[model samples]
Target: MKQFLRSGVVAATLAVAGVSGAGVALAETMNVTIVAGHPPVFRWVKHASQTFIPAVNKALEGSGTTIEWSEQYGGSLAKVGEELEAVEEGLAEIGLVSSLFDPAKLAPQNVTYFTPFVVSDSTLVSEWMDKLQSSNADMKAAWEANGLEYLGGAIGIDDYLLMTNFPVKSIADLEGRKIGAPGPAVNWLKGTGAVGVSGNLTTYYNEIKTGVYDGVIVFASAALPGKLHEVAPYITKVGFGAQYAGGFAANKDWFDGLDPAVQQALRDAAEADRIAYHADLDASVSKFLEIMTSQGATVTEVDEGFRAQWAAGMDNVAKVWAEKLDDAGVNGSAVLKDYMDTMRAAGAQPVRNWDQE
Candidate 1:
């Protein structure tokens, strides 16, 4: 590729087939390190390499500025729960900071988890979170206070499901058993007969295998790839609902120091990542479930009557969630009302009105 260039000089040079004259002068390459707690097997991590890196590289093409990405994924740079701190400390300039793991720092961002049974379309949820980050001052400030930029979007995890070793024909099927859920998602199991265990994707399989828990409330995009189905073949589609669990972010100091064009490219690339990641994720969910069933997992669909029963069985964590943060002065209730209202105005019929009641 460098051979196409007549010289590495920063001056207007002869036009190449794709690059322009102005692009001739800017042959500078900047290195950006990106990390994720989970590895590339997940769609978010995969798109970061496929969609984001290429989009940023393509967006900055003509200007001669190129980003040499040092992508450190799979917990190589930071463990599952430590990604926020890694980016905060600039261990990596950018990362897929799992807000699900850093709930205390990013509580408002977890609104979707609290208000389940709304939108199952993961892409729509991603757009909602993106819009909130841009339109809400409190959402942006939540990240700023933590030394990171929210980047305007998330790598939407597909709708959540209940995958377990035992067949769940009804809510009573899980009575007295242990269910593993990540972060605040544990709250999803509240009021149910099952005990909720705090667990993450990396540990779900082992914990279940070792009998630490009976099953997990997880997403198909991850549960399929992680082979949780092999151990826990009974998958009850409880409609735990999709969520904007985490997203790409940048270290404020490192991001603020970049050239304006580079910064714009990073932001633009993040948008690209958002669209591509969710599109791929939206498509992957059904396919993943099919693949899981084909490989011996029993997939069950909960009836409307049963889904309502399950939702009612859970505590109103959203209310508790809102008031907890409201006391911290984070406008949690406002964010909740805005999110649900936006979703409703967009033609969604939430099974439960989280903010109102």
Candidate 2:
């Protein structure tokens, strides 16, 4: 579950004396290891191979540098939630780190999850996060402090939808039920009369089938593959908004040690990877929904009134979240307001304005 390899070393060997008395230049290759906690079932994982690795290779094609990729994914390098440590420890050179799972470590990156119902478009959410990470020093420092360099921007999971076995007509149906959510997402269920269990997509199916919990807050991309529809067939498009759960990052030591051109190549490839992943995910949403429905899943979109009820009913989690951050001297309040304003400026209309309220 841990590994490291120099990613794409540009080996230029000077002419060496041989028996023939002719010096030969030897080409050096950098062996770059890329890793992820989730398997290829997720679009991010898939693109890490299909889009990112190749893009990195392509970028270094004529730069006298070639990346020999050692792709270790699906928890082979790090299990779900352990990727950050793996990369930070230099166990792996690069990895897709799940910020959502590492709340204490990556709290600033979870801004979207704290302020829900802001935007539902995955690409837009990702683009905005990219902007924020670059424009805000704290955001970038979060990664640097952790000894990791965030590559490109950040990638996102699709808009979250409620998937459960019980019919979710309104907030009433969910009362007294145990619903699973990862990290801060549990707060979204506040005042909804449902107990939110700390859970991840990997365990949703088994957990739901065994009746460990009633339902889960999940997205179509994972729900279809996890086959959660079989156990939790009731799907609700509650507009929880997309999130920056995880994205590309490299160990600071490894990244800094690489040649500048190679580093730039990796960064460029990661950016291309961001674009490709969003496009693929956007294209797959409807298909996955159809597949799940065909497999007997029931789907519904909560009405505007219902959405407002749900959003308004929740405790002021955003304000509380900001206060906690501010008390820690982390500027959580400013981050919250800035995120809300950014989303609004981009024409987002949340069911409840998390910051203003």
Candidate 3:
């Protein structure tokens, strides 16, 4: 048998002893490597191992196929935002490709971040994005263009909020404040009088404590785990809406050449991973808030009037974003309108009609 290499398919024949002593049953064995920039501590990455791999194993039972999996997480194989490139290059068979970090390649996936205050339901955002990838030509093309296949494990981040040292009774308090936001989320801070800097979960704590930033726009699910509440104890619930961060992707060439049963098994496991991740995330949100509050962090929910003021105070970055993508030939305007309309039809009333502007 030829050795299984890291970059491509590795298949072998395995013989299982027959109980009747008539002969040995032959089965196909494949080696698969999964990668993620995030460690297993995150719900998405955690479920990838706890739920996805187990589910795939169960689905492939009795199918004459067995998968040997190698999980390289926490930047062992690829750092944040590089999973797509790694998979596309065949360094790994599959990966939890984070669109939040890879903005240029996965532009359409950031539609929700551009249009905030739409809805805070992570599950809803995950489901709709998955549907769009299957139905929307441009969205599907984004993955195809990169030589990757979307495999259904949608990573839906919880609603975003502000964690600052200073109290935020109104937008006026944010003036002259240096706030850090992730990726396109910096656009959410436009015209708010605060200076927006690009940042991410990995560095938010030390940055805020060291005076690099006065505050950070983050989510509770991550804030608690990241211990961001310890550094920035004043928590303001902005409800910037849940976001579709990314999804599972496989190397196109490798995935396309797999047996149909193996392919279906991977997809089935990805769906299970999505469901388990969202459930874990949803159950943790309020519980995390309570935990943070007990630890002396003050949590405040902005009233409707204040929320409206915050929404209205921003520039129409959504329009700017769409037009920019449209100029790049990605049909950004259509995606923006489609996302906003879908949310509205699902009974979500935005604080500001970004698409309308």
- Where model 1 places Cα greater than 4 Å from the true spot, the runs are 1-26
Q: Residue-wise lDDT of candidate 1 within 46-95, one digit each (tens)?
A: 88899888988898878877666788989899988688888888677788
On lDDT, the candidate that comes out on top is 3
TM-scores of the models, in the order given: 0.91, 0.93, 0.93
When summed lDDT is taken over every stretch of 10 residues in candidate 3, the lowest stretch is: 1-10
Candidate order by lDDT, decreasing, is 3, 2, 1
- Candidate 3 per-residue lDDT, tens place, 87-175, comes to 98888989999988888999988898899899989998898888888787778899988988899989999999999998998888999
Collision pairs in model 3:
none
Alpha-carbon deviation at 22 in model 2, angstroms: 11
Rank candidates by TM-score, best first: 2, 3, 1
lDDT of each: 0.83, 0.84, 0.88
- Candidate 3 residue runs with Cα over 4 Å from true position: 1-25
- Model 2 misplacement above 4 A: 1-26
lDDT of 2 by residue, 1-357 (tens): 223445433544444664442454335587767778888987788888898888888877766667677788888888888999988987778889899888888888888888888888989888888778767776788888898888863678899999988999879988999999988999999989999999997788889999999999999988898889999989999988888887889988888777788889888888898998898889999999999999898889888888888888888888988889889878888888888888899988888887876
